[model samples]
Target: MFKGALDNIPDRVKVFLLSLTIMFCMISTVYANFYIGIDKVYTHIFYVPIILAGIWYRRKAIYVALGLGLFYIVACTVHDSIIDPDTILRFLIFLVVAGVVGSLSRARERFHSKELQAERAFRRVAKDLQLVLESTDEGIYTTDIEGRCTLINVAGARMLGYGTEEIPGRKMHQLIHHTRANGTPCPAEECCVSRSRITGVGCRISDDIFWRKDGTAFPVEYSSYPIISDEAVIGSVVAFRDITKRKQADEVRSRLAAIVESTDDAIIGTTLDGIVTTWNAGAERIYGYTAKEIIGRHISLTAPPDVKDEIAGILGRIRSGGRFEHYETVRRKKDGALINVSLTISPIVNNAGDITGASAIARDITENKRVERELQEAKAQAEMYNDLLSHDINNINQIGTGYLELALSAPNLDRGVRELLDRSLEALQNSSRLIHNVRKMQEMKATAGKLAPVDICPLLDEIRAEYSGARNGEVRIDLACGNHTRAMANDLLKEVFSNIVGNAIKHSAGPVHVGIASEEISLNNKTYCKVSVEDNGPGIPDDLKPKLFSRFQRGNTKASGRGLGLYLVKNLVEGYGGRVSVEDRVAGDPSKGSRFVIMLPASA
Candidate 1:
């Protein structure tokens, strides 16, 4: 009740004034016949302001009360009829009692105020710390000594699926369903929160699964420290952080490391400071250096002296966001033997998406290079013979056709001779179609011309609709290209795609379906326009695929005439600077026909 009354004063000055008034009233009793009677209980009212002022104003109120008590006693002495030792002693005793009470009350008030200030300051610091913790992207949570939640930051709340309002003052261990990252339970005895309460220090904990509000689980890392007061454990502040992303990244890194280690190509990495950071098993096999021996060492140690300039150039390009692909070079191995290697170097990007270092994948292509050279020599000799045969065949066919016509027009020819001449012309027609295949093979191998931009979507549609309309078939043309795509010459694309569609229509036993699509593709840092023609028909036999693109090769020689459609397609496409290949349609069953892909440069 007294605390409530003292609470009214807003300032220390008001407390001092109130204390003075009460002290004056208390002294009035001392002068009233100097009779300090039980009615002096009224003087106890003066204790009100004395206690209030002491608690509120401290030393200031104590001094005012003491002065008021003494002044009252001096005024009583001057106004009274007689001066007596008992009166003086009584006045002195009263003065001492008032002073003692004021002093004691003031002391207690100072102590209480200091404690209140300390508490306010602590709360302020906590507010600021909480703001900082929540603002960070990392998860943070705090638990008390009894393993109850005192605070959980926003990031922590999101990670654990528990809000601060939902978990604070609640025992965290009971609510948190602990498990391993792989979903196995983490037994209560080994839990970090329980252990931290027993040990009054901070320690790192790993591989714990934290439960979500909906009962789902995610991995987290827990670090806990006990809060001590007066050398005794009061509570603990445990910081729990969700390490799911970190763990995932670690798994990916491990997988990538395993891939590089198991590969035949040498994979090595260096830090920006020039020290080797990673050396895989492939590196060990090729370079003859154990990973333990070379790691943490400079890469320049094994580099050949002549390659110093090349290495500098590669590093410069990588720093400028360029990749080095198929860069053939020589390097000395640990055995002091020079080895030929094809190096592919790229930048190793950090979490901030900046290149922090570089990686090199080295392939020993010495045998491959040697075999490729031999193959080129053999192919040149064979092509030379084929071209000569095609030229000779063409000349013979022209001479035979001209002579047959000239012989038939002779004035004295008999009906029997005319019939023989007609039979010979029919045989020559069959021979001429066979010769066209050889000519096509030579054309396909000829040097290509510069690629010019051509749009072939409309042309493809035109051919499909025209053929379908002419044949009056149920086959449908599905044109999926919306945007205009540019490729090589129109005539070349038309020849290739028309042959592919025509082949599909001929081979299909039922209603044929055709689809055309175009897109841009990048390969070896160069972009190209790609067009695909797909059909639903009987698939090509695996045995026939070897000769599928060769001249005079046909799936059904009876239905597909002359075996020159695809042969002509191959020649025309290559002459315009493009490539042609086949694959199964994505949506079609294995029984259905396949798709043929034609990749051409958008422009030279």
Candidate 2:
């Protein structure tokens, strides 16, 4: 404000000249001393400028005073005025007055210089304070006792969507804090900021709403304090900032805590060093220990002594940013009873993707483990019982079949009775074959992956010959292959071939023609020996072909109704890292018989 008032004066010289003219007019026209002062007023015109310059310019006024005296002395000589004693006295007196003013001017100039230096320092400090006010992110404003804005910094003006010049003297609360967060009006008298001034007390409001010029409200955390002087509240200063993100963070934390408390599986949080940092309600229920007994303690506190080291090892891996999941182990309860649990550990990482800790979820699996043990025991008992029954049944079947055969060979036996005997013996034979296939299925499991290279050309030829002889009618079988096709196989490879060929012969309406072919094929950069056996008998239906190799598949299943031959073939072929599939011999035509294709890993 002082700088502004000084700027109104256009020139310092003009001010000095104007003031000097005024002083001369008064002194020359209106002054009269009791002792010849009227005549003495003539020299006073020169004295006025000298005195004025001395007071303003300090010792520099001496030069101006000397120039004026020389001009006056030269004018007296031209104007014919006598050089009287009193005239010399007046000139000397003028010189003495100039010296006296010069001393006074020095004192005044020093004082004025100090004032200017202090003003410049104040401007610099004010500039720094303005920069600070404009540069901050938080809003800062002050209000008078009447709740009208007295001053508002640049940040506060921008936050309220108002210009810095426009905010002062307006009611700040109506503009920025009129509406509550619940969309209700807020009374100025009830406002905390107003009360801070009216009551001379301070208040900190963490959750509130402040409005912008566009009438949008956002979450705010603000502090308000009375601006007091001499024990009297004059105004208030309020500082505030947006707290939207902080509020959202708090809400998310609340929901997560609820989930942790409500879970049925033990959910726990641990530090990298295996110290338990959090334990949920589920953890308490599963471990029989409350949160108060567990948190801040080592996780190994709950692990039994035998698995304590293993638990430490898992925590170590998780600390290094590894995930350990679904590990089944045993842990001792608070009551010293042991129970099985499936444990999973996952690393918890910060924004930098550095693992700081781990979360562990544990679910009890004692009942599942108990059921699994009982199932295994039941299967073993069933196997023993089957072995005993099969042994005794086979002996009875052998005796019955022998007696039927002897009766059929008797002389002059009726043809119908002989046919009955033949069918009975065949039925017994089929039963024995079924039993043997069941035993073979079990034996294959015991010797799984025990494969050796077997040349299949001889095996195919032998099955064709054996099946052809067994069929009474004209049954033709053709074999085409490389000279020697060796594949990874055990002795059971012959059984696979025998089952397919025997099905063709048995299911034929009359004379049937079967074709067998073998070749080498490449798949995924590996060599596999491929073979296809197709028959021209009444073919299988498209729908039934999928289940043709499964157990107890009868007329439509390429397997005997009471036998497990084809099912055993599927298991055996797959166990050798091979596969078996069936299709119609003629494309899309099931009545033209079926084709069984097999692929096996080629022997090296």
Top model by lDDT, which number?
A: 2
- Candidate 1, residues 429-518, lDDT tens digits: the string is 556756764554454445246345777668767776766732466677777764656776644456577668877776776677888787
lDDT of 1 at 37: 40
Error of 2 at 369 (Å): 2.8
Q: Which parts of model 1 are misplaced by more than 4 Å?
A: 1-158, 163-165, 168-171, 178-187, 198-203, 225-237, 271-276, 286-289, 292-308, 328-341, 351-355, 387-441, 450-604
Model 1 lDDT, residue 572, Cα: 77
* Every candidate's lDDT: 0.72, 0.81
User: Where does the lowest 10-residue lDDT sum fall in candidate 1?
Assistant: 36-45
lDDT of 2 by residue, 512-576 (tens): 89899998888999888899999998888877777777777765633334747778989999999
Q: Predict model 2's lDDT versus the native.
A: 0.81
Quick one: best TM-score, which candidate?
2
lDDT over C-alpha atoms for residue 420 of model 2:
87
Per-model TM-score versus the true fold: 0.57, 0.71
